[model samples]
Target: MFKILDKQELAESIIEYTIEARDIARHHHAGQFCIIRVHSHCERIPLSIAETNSQAGTITLVVQIAGHSTQELAQLEAGDSILDVVGPLGQPTKIGSPRRGIFVGGGVGVPAGSSMVRQMKQAGAQVLAIIGFRSKDLIIYEEKMRAVADELVVTTDDGSYGYHGLVTEPLQERLAAGEKYDVVITVGPVVMMRAVAEVTRPYGTHTIASLNPIMVDGTGMCGACRVTVGGETKFACVDGPEFDAHQVDFAELAQRLEIYRDEELRAHEAGPHECRLEQALKELG
Candidate 1:
């Protein structure tokens, strides 16, 4: 059992949990993720490794309560035990010795980008970070990001904080201003990533995007996380949670993500334990 050492509500419907997973913390690198099971019977869900502390023997996961599993995870308190936490899965972001790099993260993606920024800075790259949220109330990891990034630009769609537009605005503005970067990394909603890729493509800047698709098993065995990159099938679990944004088939990925929408809503509406009970009753009947 992975023990929850601490928990904090970062924003409305978003929570951060520090879990005691010594091995994972010690070995995890930037851009890797973990598959967690809230309980034995609960469906497994993937969460990006937001941060890790080797000495503390813990890894931090920032979760937005978007579904039944996440909602249950949000309800867990400090000292609670997670039934299973398996990971440090997926390839780490390849932060070679680039002279300058820009990382764009939206909403919960901010936490996922934090470690990458830190790693890039440590690699002697000048890192610029652009983080976006729906509003000020949704923003998270600002201070953490600022600490690692050479420049940090925060944006909100509603003009509630920082720049009054999407993260792409600042990125485009900088690129248009003749500012050059060796690489661009974006992690966010599919649409946001697509926009970033489009913006960087004409500039001939190398871009990487982290994909969050429907995943189960957290291993190559399931093939549920399979995605087409450069017209080839690649599993996000084993091949990547990060890929070349320029070659990704975003439309196909977006459609696949919605395959279980109705079923997910029904399960969520039925409540976690209640859904299990209904299944058990159906079996007996």
Candidate 2:
């Protein structure tokens, strides 16, 4: 069992968890993720490694409560133990020492992208970060991203904070102004990632996108997280959670993600399986 060292709510239904996993924390690199199981019976879920503290033997995971399993995870507090926490999984991003790089993120993706931002800066790259949220209340990891990026641009769709526009707006503006980046990396919803790819396409910028697919196992054996890039197949679990944005078949990827929608909705509606009746019976006993 891995203990929950700390837990803080970053936003509504969004949590930042610091868990005790020494080896994983020590070896995890930028752009890698972990698969966690709240209990032995719960389904496993993948989450990006937001930060790590090797000395403390902890790894930080930012989790958004989306369905049953995550809702169960949220119920646990500091000192609670998790049944399984496996990883440092997937490929660590290849930073290549680009002279100038742009990192874009949307919603919860902001924290995920922050990992790469720090690495790019350490690689001696001038990093520009553009992060967006639906509103001010949804913004997270702003200070963290800002500290690593040479410049940071925050956007909101509702004009509630920062720039009153989509994240792609500032990116488009920058490219239109003749700004060139050695590479552009975006992590967000499929639609948002696709938009970033399109915005950079005209400028011929080399762009990378971190993908979120339906993953059963964190290993390649499951074959559940396969995606098409450059008209070929690759698994998100083992091959990547990141790929060339321009080469990805976004439509197919988006369609594949929705395959479990009904089941997911049912799980959410069913709520956490604490079995109140059984609990009451045990109390009587």
What tens-digit string does per-residue lDDT give for candidate 1 at 39-103? 97787779999999999999999998987778888889999999999999999999689999999
lDDT: worst 10-residue window of model 1: 276-285
Residue 67 displacement in candidate 2 (angstroms): 1.2
What lDDT does model 1 reach? 0.90
How does each model score on TM-score? 0.95, 0.94
Sum up the clashes in candidate 1.
0
CA shift of 204, model 1, Å: 1.0
Model 2: per-residue lDDT, tens digit, 1-285? 999999999999999999999999999999999999898667788999999999999999999988777888999999999999999999999869899999999988888888799889888999999999999998899999988899999999999999999999999999999998999999988999999999999999999999998777678986678899999999999999999999999999988677565566766666666433223223434
Candidate 1 lDDT for residue 138: 92
The models' CA-based lDDT, in order, is: 0.90, 0.89
Q: Which stretches of candidate 1 lie over 4 Å from their true place?
A: 274-285
